[model samples]
Target chain A: MSPNKLLPLLVLLAVAPAWASEPAPARQKELVHLVRQDCGSCHGMTLQGGLGPSLLPADLRDKPAEGLAATIYYGRPGTPMPPWKQFMSEAEAQWIVDKLMSEFPQ
Target chain B: MKLILSLFLAALLGACATPQPLRGTGDLGLVIERATGHVTLVNTSSRQPYARIAGLGDLSHASAVYSRDGRYAFIFGRDGGLTKIDLLEGKIVKRVIQAGNAIGGSISQDGRIVVAQNYTPGGIKAFDAETLELLAEVPAEYAPGQFSKVVGLADSPGNKFVYALFDGGEIWVTDFSNPRQPTTQRYPAGKQPYDGLVTPDGRYFLAGLFGEDGVAMLDLWQPEKGARKILENYGRGEEKLPVFKMPHLRGWSVAQGKAYLPAIGRHEVLVVDVATWKEVGRIPVRGQPVFVMARPDGRQVWVNFAFPDNGKMDVIDTLAGKVVHAFEPGKGILHMEFTPRGENIWLSARDDHKVLIYDTARFTKQGEIAADSPSGIFFTARAARIGF
Candidate 1:
């Protein structure tokens, strides 16, 4: 294959893992419960605001999804937002970010 | 005509029969639902929630203290709502919003007064336990224009309330023996006392320090000596993980003449000898320990951590001074309470919306009761215990 054709194949191989790493439907449901109830302990149950800030779609609309996912993964230092990396994978954090951007599950 | 009259008489007798009353040793309790500001009345014997009462307001960090008879519960809410709940009726008897922002509260030793410690517009207010009527206000003012947030308010032995000044770094004891003119005494504790609790025997009041690396202990038997720092520099040189939430020392684990305290920003519980006020050892845990609770018999210490690892739980054998068992009961395990004799442990898994009951002896899942986003579990048996 030509070099230009090889580049497309490399890109596809690189991105394939990311797409395949999405949490299973059952796992996604559990994560949804965790964010809504566990995280909701600090952030309000509706994600409005409490000990932590509002995590609603409207409040998080301005921030980039990737940044939010990173925050969820690494956590904000010196804050009550704990690192979810121990409990979740990078892909799972992204899944939470996507859910937060839309109407998060109750 | 005779047969009709007999049926009518039977129906009248059935209608007049009164309902049977609740039995068992008043082991009933309330589980604070943080999300919706409600409490679920639970009976340990039945292992089920009988009723749920709502509208206490901002129960995110709420706590409750029982009346002497254990029939009434005084719920202190985060939004400064003090609600007096009747356990038998499963309803709020009276509620009063006395502050802008409140943390927790304490009931006097005599059970006559209830005191709430506040954050916003910082002060402590005393109210009549029966009526929820404000009796007095003691502002935590360190300077002319500065007000310190109150933390770790606990009722000591002599009808007195003791609390820590988060901003002022001081511990104050207000004797409500007089009710109106409380005799106040101040002692300098460590920096930023986050939460405090009286010992089971009500001998010492220990406060966890947030701004520093030690705990301040005040001997209630000898208040003239003032607060002394223990376990100093315990976390001085160690690199700390980012603190998600401050470890609450209110429900600290005490068993067999020792205390198992959560070390801030560390996945370890500091074991302290109560007699010597010395660090005996540190038990490594699965994550940052939130509540290190001793079993009723002092044989094991059960620990639950902060988020990410909140799903995990560790059971430490008090004698071995090590984690014997670690399990994930469910996601978001918030609070735990053991049966009076420590036969079973009731744990609130907030994410699962269930309170799991585990057999302490066999360490097996016995049963579970459905709850909302539950956080704190308080039982009527606490009414008889000191510093519950």
Candidate 2:
């Protein structure tokens, strides 16, 4: 392919899926609420840790995002953390992990 | 004209100086607004909220214990906030950040002390009910540098407190007779005792196990004997569902001759014969039960569920051994409290931001009070109960 055509193709590939990767704005709000209320039942509402570990940026920084996403999607077996796949998509779980790795929304 | 003006000023001054009515807190209660760190001081008799007091932090998993007089409420917030609120005064008397993470707490039999259960740097700390001053600290350090999260801390008879160690798998009883220098007795409990409850009679301390099939029971009358397991494998040979939220058991779970308790990872409420301490029956319900409580009359049992199923509640007919009625109050049905005589039940619909009151006998809505993400509904009558 020509250089100009390749550059345009690259931009389209990069921009299109980026929007698709994260959940939509409305669903994003629901996911945030899920993390704050439902997940907050065991993990502290402040994400400071309770029966479950903390999800604050400091606590989640060292952990792999993929592992955290898997934990959310599949749940940690033999633990109280139940699988959330029925409630959210795997991509949504990854979005939650990314938010936890940074500062979670209030 | 000057004399008339003076008289008017005198009357206005007298009205301004007059205090609130001389009343008791017998009908007063509290509604914890979890998300906003505020508590609505509600009068159960009127089914209305009189005041909304704030500043208690991170009440996500908060629970409260009443002072002996029923005038003060000691709120234990998840963010480690131990706030003592004066119900009569409609204000916070005192608050302290005594830990990094606290689960719940209980008051002594004499009502002179309030003990808080902590998860971070796990331990149970005692404070003076009057001054909120530190009285004692019993570290849940089962092993060196290893502390277990304390759960189900209940005040028993003889001015003692009993609690379960989640990580250490033990039950510990401490006598607050000498508040500053308390003595503790430990008993080896089953694996992962998630919550503990002192029987209404104050004779037994039962720890609900999460990692195993049975609950550990200790006879307070005979402390020499070790804890024994009861309700062994009630759900054995069955596939266990994921526990979206842990079940909570209080002392008042017993009704008539049976005890209605939450079944871990199961969609039923396990009924055990209190006399024999064995599973007599089970009532299948909507989802994993969180709070299984019997009305003060013991004729009916009310229950709320955990996440994904958290919006529904079941009313069990104790005599029929089955769920007589079920209803979804709203999203996030967090907690429920019945009146002293069990005539009316208050249900906290957290996500709906309302506290709905229903008449127990007719199963009809009586009132709904607006709140901000309400969770726990505590009444002053709890002050007179043994293990509130």
Candidate 3:
């Protein structure tokens, strides 16, 4: 194929996924806001962690949401992380855990 | 060599530069730079011959109980080893490691039995005070890991029964009159029964409900009826509270027919009238007060922070119903116990890795015994070993 003909195809392949995957910036702002209201009081506003482990990139930002939700539901023994199942519904923890894993400490 | 010497000198200078206050607050302020095999003591008074225990080996999380006779210090290591130290001689005379996991333990009034709570395979192992021999293993209700078993074994006011708090809100009452096969009573109460105490009257048993909201007042006198809710400190009334989210950690000071419930989340002590099951008064606290021990005189209440940095001990004059005085101990203050004479107070400084001694009368700092990595400490009036 001609070099000039290949250039257009390469550009389309490279930018298509990037543009498609990017969510509106407002959605990102809403997730950050949720974390601040839900977990910030105990974990600290910066998500640096206190009374609980840090939720930043180095700790749990990329971990599985199910595992994180399990920890929230079952709670860690001998730790302050009491099971939120009694207070929050299963779907509630999943939503917060999803937001936490994806957008926390951004 | 000279560079190393210079660095050592600089470090020493920094340690000496600060003016050592006669007394400070919390466990974090108590720093033991070196680890030792002997238990350290701080003379928090202006008296004579202040000596701290040292040289105790990597015995982190050792439960230290001072003998009632005031001559020896018994420390139970996490690995099931027990060290009997002669306080006067400042040496370990006896060391014994028996079978079982030691999660929680309390020395009896006569100091004849050391009841250690086992976690993995839930149960209580009774050991002879002097010999450290396994006397009996009292089977717990739940299986291993089912419940975070925290036992509270204290000689009843009558010295009759040794009580245990199993996981899932059950209290096991064992008649210690015969350690071989004591009459046991298993009654349901509350979740995560963390800390507990038997009232001097031996009528009602109080266990701190960590998972639930308040104190599970087990009526031993009426076991068939089970434990009644004398007070709930965690959640907002009538609503079941979730763990870690609401009022969880609570401390106890039971004496003179009153249970001083220090709810960490509420920052207050819920004084309960044992006989009537009523809320007497709310005593304010400084920070997350983890422990509330009644002074021997039964007139004052001493409270220390659970997470440190909450400077000062909450001293409550029972009659006045107000915080009379607050003394800064240090940052990592865990729990405090009084000497047999009730003149000295010993505190486990986890952050500083030292046991702090405070003068109860003067409410001033006396001296500090440097523990290499001290965790839990207690002093019993029934101790058999003493030095000097």
Instruction: Choose the strongest candidate by TM-score.
Output: 2
Question: Which of 1 and 2 is the better model by TM-score?
Answer: 2
Winner on DockQ between 1 and 2 is 2
Clashes of each: 1, 0, 48
Model 2 lDDT at residue B125: 96
Tens digits of per-residue lDDT, candidate 1, B1-388, equal 4465346434533543444376643789989978778788888887876767878888877899999899999998877789999888777899999987788899998899989988766879999998988888899987788988888898888888888998889999999998877878999998878789998888889999877789999999999999999999899788777666667887665799999999987889999998899999999998888888989899999999987788999999998889989999998888899888889899998767778999988899989876666789999888876676
- RMSD, one per candidate, in order: 9.9, 7.6, 11.2
TM-score of 1: 0.80
Query: TM-score of every model?
Result: 0.80, 0.92, 0.63
- TM-score, structure 2 vs. true: 0.92
Deviation of model 1 at B366, angstroms: 1.4
After superposing candidate 3 on the true structure, give the runs of residues whose Cα lies further than 4 Å from its correct spot: A1-106, B1-37, B41-61, B66-72, B108-111, B143-148, B157-161, B221-225, B238-252, B255-257, B308-312, B339-362, B367-388
Where is model 1 chain B poorest over a 10-residue stretch in terms of lDDT? B11-20
lDDT of 2 by residue, A1-106 (tens): 9997786456435445433697888988999988899899889888899988888988886887778989999998876778989888888887788778766888
The RMSD (Cα, Å) of candidate 1 is 9.9
What is candidate 3's lDDT per residue for B1-388, written digit by digit as tens?
Answer: 4465346435543544354555321111112222234444333334221334444443433456545655555665444556676545445667776533443356665667666665434667777778777778776755554644445655553334444454556777776667666567777777766656666655667776766676777776677888766676544664332323222222244567776776735567778787687888888787656567777776788887533233457888887887898877765565676765567777766445456777777887767654433445544342432110
